[model samples]
Target chain A: MSQEPAVIDVPFEPHGLPPSVAGAAATTVSVSVTDLRNLRYDWVASAIPGRLLDAPLPIHSSFYETYHETPIKAANDVPRTIADALRGQLAAQGYRIGPDHADIRIGVIRFHEDIPSAQTMNNCFYNLIPETVSVVAIAAALVEVVDASDRPVFVKYYHAAHKVTPWCSPGQPIWAPSLLSLYRTNLIAAMRDMVGQIIGDSHFQEALAKGGRP
Target chain B: MKGAVIALAACALLTACGSIRFAVPYPSVGTPARTPGAANEIVNVVAKDDRTDPGGAVGRNGWQTLVPSNDPAGALAGGMRAELAARGYTVAPGHAQATLDLVSFAVDFLPNDLPLQASPGAPGGTVIATVGIIVIVRDPVARPVFAHYLQVHAAKPYYFNTSNAPDARTVLSEAMQSAITGMIADPAFQQAARRAQ
Candidate 1:
């Protein structure tokens, strides 16, 4: 039997630029962003307790499944997605994207999506059996900024969660949306929400303004 | 039939006997150039796990216990030593001015606020990892110059049967790193370390 790989790399693509300051003119402040995500563990499977057939009850047995069985073609790279999005937003605000000798440096400590599943009552069984599954998408990140001297200037954590699907009955009809598609939707929405929080922070903007100054 | 039932029960017990273990890699500290005088300071670093249950059962998924592969106290100490050394501080025993104690390293799975009824199958929750430490800086005569308690929390979403070892590891790692970072970033801690003889 083949051993399961310790980490499974999932491709991610964040959507368009986060909402920038309306009519906010661009600045000449240059910045560089780094991906500092821990690469050791990647695959976080969503699990649910198994339902016994005879008793029609949930048991301690857990059934685990990944968001994707195999890697999917990503529109943007996995870890780079957040950094790239931040750069894009900064560029929109008229900040120069320079990796070499930038005034402000930002590090992304965490950037990932989690799919949380819960058991709800399914209408199929007259709401008698609490076997219907509901899933939600959650995204979170820890970002830090440093000045030219690499002195820690600011740090903030961001989080966003949204329900992906309502209570889905067990063995629902084939016409329902695929599990992968639901996951993708959740991921995209959560990423956008989280990245938006970072871009819109006044402290973040202030750090950029004061970077590399004497 | 009775014998078959007994055999099945035994199998279940055997499967749940051991915990799922994962190692927490040393957290990467960003930008160690905090204080100009920090490079010359010699910090005697002491780390110990003071938790009552150091068996390392951080959380539970179904019937399985999640634990760290190595001692969490040791890991925290090793990470602290590396971080301090990276900042150009001399980390060694004897006549040390700085001491760190890992009081608690715990990860808890709290069920998320959902409209659905709670059950084993629908166990959706948030994984909250917390790290608590005490930092002490002393004079040459072992007099306490500055002492403070620093605690940090990192959280991630937990999906009933879905969240696994990697999820737990990620949160735990973040908590550990945050604890160290919080300590180093404190203005008081820096002042004490700099004043340590």
Candidate 2:
């Protein structure tokens, strides 16, 4: 049997970018994000370390079957579809603005949940999600660029959620802005902060490269 | 008088058997294995942890991001079987003098309310989390061969950005992967199964 390589740590490298994003913003860069499962917020952003813009997704509907084992086209259609939508949104915003030398780059990340917590839905808690929560358990990972070295960065992201979309139906086709508009709002705000953090670090790295900041 | 003595003896035997409590039975698969030359010890794993992604610095709507999945018991059992088979072991009901029986396992999500940094109203929100598996392995006499406890800590950046909510799929996948990956990497697990002489 062919075994995979053993996982180990890279001790020489010091800092780390946020795992959920595509890449860091040391300088202006173009990146792509693919949300094949069709997410509402549409994740690519320009964080402090790098910029995670839009990229074509590798979603093949043929990679899967429905929950009932029925043949369905997308391995993760909704998220990937939404990713396409996000790209359109960015282009519409005239994102080609700002400095040519300033931090510009792209990053992409994917998140998934393993199982939804049904029991918690029954129990009442302050921050607990609503009951129709289908436990859209997701598994996530980030693929980014190491701003300091132009190296590709890949990392994992994680979370468990009961609710994915508001239009609660077993087959209603999840990712709807109606259900996620509120969530989308929060994700964008966080992206700005995260991007800023990544970019700031990149600027610091560049300064050292140029023999200290002017 | 004979009846009373018989009852007392039965109670003693029951106590000697050990305690087995399964919090909840969820269907899944896993791999178990027993090291070579260690017939007296068996390490039956129910579920091996999976890997991760990025989402929910703060969950959408300010919900706590990074909640971990509870135990997928069936998966663990299946995983143990597969692992042992790869290692070359005979499975089934048989007495090899000493045996390892999976008595119980539990996975939970509790509110740590623990903050990564700190923020006002951070209440600091609910943490969808996972404390690793509680595996109790018993010897032939039903004594605990090994009892282990672990908590899978998921580290990812998910800020509360009201403008964009994280993809539920992305968040859950990443957290599950991280927790599972960590589980297999744990030194404690290795130590527990290190050929008990």
Candidate 3:
């Protein structure tokens, strides 16, 4: 049976803060970004929660291939876009973008779009027939607050996944350009939600306020 | 009429209870034609398959399945060499400018019996094929310029019918083809392959 689509609220209540810079905040924040996802495939598509089942190797008759090679710009371009968006979000929260030595440094740990088939399949088959696609965008980071001496004062990790949908109908194939476009659109929306979640959280706001200008 | 019924019942039993082995083709179509003398940089390609036979899956009536061949590492190395050669890079036996190694090749299926069903076919289940490669680009002096591990994954949905061998062949071929295409299409890969010796 298909369960209802999972609903997640943003800025999930922060767990009690740890000591050291526990109550610190900064006005200037620098962000370090990294892209670790496999850019070859359009997206992670799906990660079955448990162990995968083994099967036989049916593909026989080996042969060579010579095909035109096209660079995966879309996958390469996503990290830059997310970094730019985060900068804007941070600026709006009264944080200045600065060099690596800035008081607040946020390092992006992982960012990708996850489309779970089980969720999509359930959404389409159980809740409603003739279903559309379902996708979740993920953004995770490590936040480090340093004293003026560059000593680590406090550190916290944050990760968020948001469901965004244009729900491609069954008619829309996975490789269809339109589906990729929709996924990109949904990814942006999900990222925006995460930014809002982080900036609006009471704990983060307090951190920024401690040494913040505003 | 009664004979037809008995024959149909027997066929269903064979399909549902018996194991089926499918021979899927390696993806070689649509590869770009060899580029004319782009460069003389030599590249080495090596690969291997890591899936165990009668592998860890349980399908209907204990039906087990496989996707690639017993030795896909050999197949992938051959394919990679051909692809590099077509890109105008000279593939070599040793002391090359770059080496491409196939780290692993694997496939896992959901509802593992997508190609095994009773008389009529019903659509469900997905097959995911994953290929991992490591590219080491070296300068003329045998100095490593860059190295990176690249993995590609392809998934296809399938339906099983009384005669599933054909469907299995098609799906498995497509999955492998997609993976190969994905690997060579990497921007880093292009940059490395096109570098002058």
Highest DockQ model number: 1
Q: Taking the tens digit of each residue's C-alpha lDDT, what string does model 3 give over B81-180?
A: 7677777767775534545554334454554332223234455355555555555555555444445555555567655444444544554456556555
**Tens-digit lDDT string for candidate 3 (A12-69):** 2222322233223346666555554443333322222111211222211110001111
lDDT of 1 by residue, A46-163 (tens): 3221111111111222211111122122234544666666677777765666632234444443333332223222222133334324444445454555556654455444556655
> Model 3 reaches what TM-score against the true structure?
0.41
**By TM-score, how accurate is candidate 2?**
0.24
Q: Model 1 chain B — which ten-residue stretch has the worst lDDT?
A: B1-10
- The segments of candidate 1 whose C-alpha lies over 4 angstroms from its true place after superposition are A1-41, A44-76, A99-106, A116-128, A131-133, A165-167, A173-177, A212-214, B1-59, B63-197
The digit string of per-residue lDDT tens for model 1 on B18-59 reads 367777656767767746677678777776555434664665
The true-versus-predicted C-alpha distance at residue B70 of model 3, in Å, is 2.4
Q: What TM-score, over all chains together, does every model reach? A: 0.46, 0.24, 0.41
Model 3 ranges with Cα > 4 A deviation: A1-214, B1-24, B29-37, B48-62, B95-119, B125-128, B139-143, B148-157, B162-168, B185-187, B194-196
TM-score of chain A of each: 0.62, 0.29, 0.56
The fraction of correct interface contacts reproduced by each prediction comes to 0.00, 0.00, 0.04
Ranking by lDDT: 1, 3, 2
What C-alpha lDDT values do all the predictions have? 0.54, 0.29, 0.46
**Candidate 2 lDDT score relative to the true structure:** 0.29
Per-prediction count of colliding residue pairs? 7, 122, 18
Global Cα RMSD, each model: 13.2, 21.7, 14.7
* The 10-residue segment with the lowest total lDDT in model 3 chain B: B53-62
List DockQ, one per candidate, in order.
0.05, 0.02, 0.04
